[model samples]
Target chain A: DVKVTQSSRYLVKRTGEKVFLECVQDMDHENMFWYRQDPGLGLRLIYFSYDVKMKEKGDIPEGYSVSREKKERFSLILESASTNQTSMYLCASRTGGIVNTEAFFGQGTRLTVV
Target chain B: AQSVTQLDSQVPVFEEAPVELRCNYSSSVSVYLFWYVQYPNQGLQLLLKYLSGSTLVKGINGFEAEFNKSQTSFHLRKPSVHISDTAEYFCAVTPSGNTPLVFGKGTRLSVIA
Candidate 1:
């Protein structure tokens, strides 16, 4: 079974503070993604990394960035945390298969910005 | 570009009842469709996927979905649902290759005793 683990299951930060969410996958998948889930908004991609040190902006990338220093780890960074940034963040990884690869996700980190 | 639309926001059914969650997508190119379920406080899990070969795909938890290219719809259904099936179901689509999936707003399934 594939395992995707997030660094924190819950986090709290003050406004204007910086925050980091870490994720690691044991499957050594080539593609990793970061997404913020909101009620009625579903899962919107924030950033994704196809290879080490390479990243691409998803639909909503403002105020957020990502790092993929290694194949097994992906990190999401918030430049300046705001109250509106409080939401559940998810990390997922997928292999490089021709067909649609099934993405495995971590439990998710629920960040609260006060 | 691709987008998914889940027409139903919520569906309530009693145990052992049948249910259907509707999903539609808009894409100019051929795409892969998927149904994912998220339990409370948990991450999304793949319930089923429609890539090729068969139009009807069966997944875990006795869930299945039919991909209708003509209708541009991929709807999930279950004949007899259990209370454990209560979760948020999301429909997603991606173009061939390494493109990221576009997800719908999701449909929350609530199964009562």
Candidate 2:
């Protein structure tokens, strides 16, 4: 089974603090994504990386940045965490072959910005 | 740009009852549709996907979805739902080859006993 692991299952940070959420995939997939899950909004894409050192902004990328220094790891960074940024963050990876490729997700990290 | 719409935000059904979660999409090119389920405090899992061929696609946990190209809809259904089936379901769409997926708001399924 493809495994995508997140650095933390839950995190709490004070306002204006910097926060980082890490994700690693063992399948060697070329595409990685970061998303935030909210009650009514569902899952909104924050950022995505197609290759090492490459990144693309998704629908809602404000206040968030991503890093893809290596193929297997993707990191989501919150420059200044705020209460509005508290959400369940998810990471997913998929192969480069086709767009229909199934993405494997990691157990999300629930971040609480106080 | 591709976009998805999940009409129902919440669906409540009795255990062993049939259920359907409606989803619609707008895309310029041929699209690939997918239904994903996310349990409480967990990640989203692929329930089913409709790439091509047979319009009906069956997935894990006895969940299935039908792809209607003409209607631009891909609705997920289950003959009989269980209590364990309670979760948030999301419908997503993407263009044929190599593109990012556009997800709908999601439908929350609450199975009552």
Candidate 3:
């Protein structure tokens, strides 16, 4: 089965601290995405990468950034963590191109900024 | 750009009863629709997707959804539900060949004994 692995399942960071959440997919998928899931809001995409070294901002990309240095690895970064940034982060990957396909998701990382 | 709207925020029903979760979308172009379920404190799982062809799509765990092009809606349904069916269901859409999928606010299903 295809596997998407997230680096952490739960994390706590102090305000103003830089934080990183990592993800890796073994399916060799070319597209990787980072989304923040909150109660009532569901899942909101923060950023998505169609290829290595290429990224695009999603609707709610205000306080988050992402990096895809390698094909299998995509990383989400919080330059300065804040209380409002506390939420469950999810990583997903899908095949390349615009073909209709469902994304495989990780177990998710729940972050709390204190 | 594409947007999805889940008409109901929460639906409660007794076990063995039929249920339907309504979803609608607005987009200028043709799109792909999907229904995902997220159990408590877990990642989202694909329940079903409607890309093309038949409007009635059957998914895992005895769930199915119908894609109505005229109404621009994809509603998930099940003839009979179980206690294990309790989860948050999200409706998503992306313009055919789009990057990110736009998601709805989600509908929480509560199964009563």
lDDT of each: 0.94, 0.91, 0.92
For A1-114, candidate 3 gives per-residue lDDT tens digits of: 889999999999999999999999999898899999988887899999999999998879998888888999999999999999999999999886757798889999999999
Worst 10 residues of 1 chain B by lDDT: B94-103
lDDT of 2 by residue, B1-94 (tens): 8889999999999999999999999988888888999998889899988888999999999999889889999999999999999999999987
| Reference-based lDDT, residue A54, model 3 | 95
Pull out the clashing pairs in model 1. Answer: none
Better of 1 and 2 by lDDT: 1
2 against 3, candidate with superior TM-score: 3
Cα error, candidate 3, residue B20 (Å): 0.2
TM-score of each: 0.98, 0.97, 0.98
- How much is the lDDT of residue A39 in candidate 3? 87
Better of 1 and 2 by TM-score: 1
Question: In model 1, where do residues sit more than 4 Å from their true spots?
Answer: none
Candidate 3 interface CA RMSD, Å: 1.4
Task: Give one digit per residue, the lDDT tens place, for model 3 in B1-113.
Answer: 78899999999999999999999999999888999999988888999999899999999999999999999999999999999999999999987544778899999999999
Off by over 4 Å in 2: none
Question: What are the per-model DockQ values?
Answer: 0.72, 0.67, 0.71
i-RMS for every candidate: 1.4, 1.7, 1.4
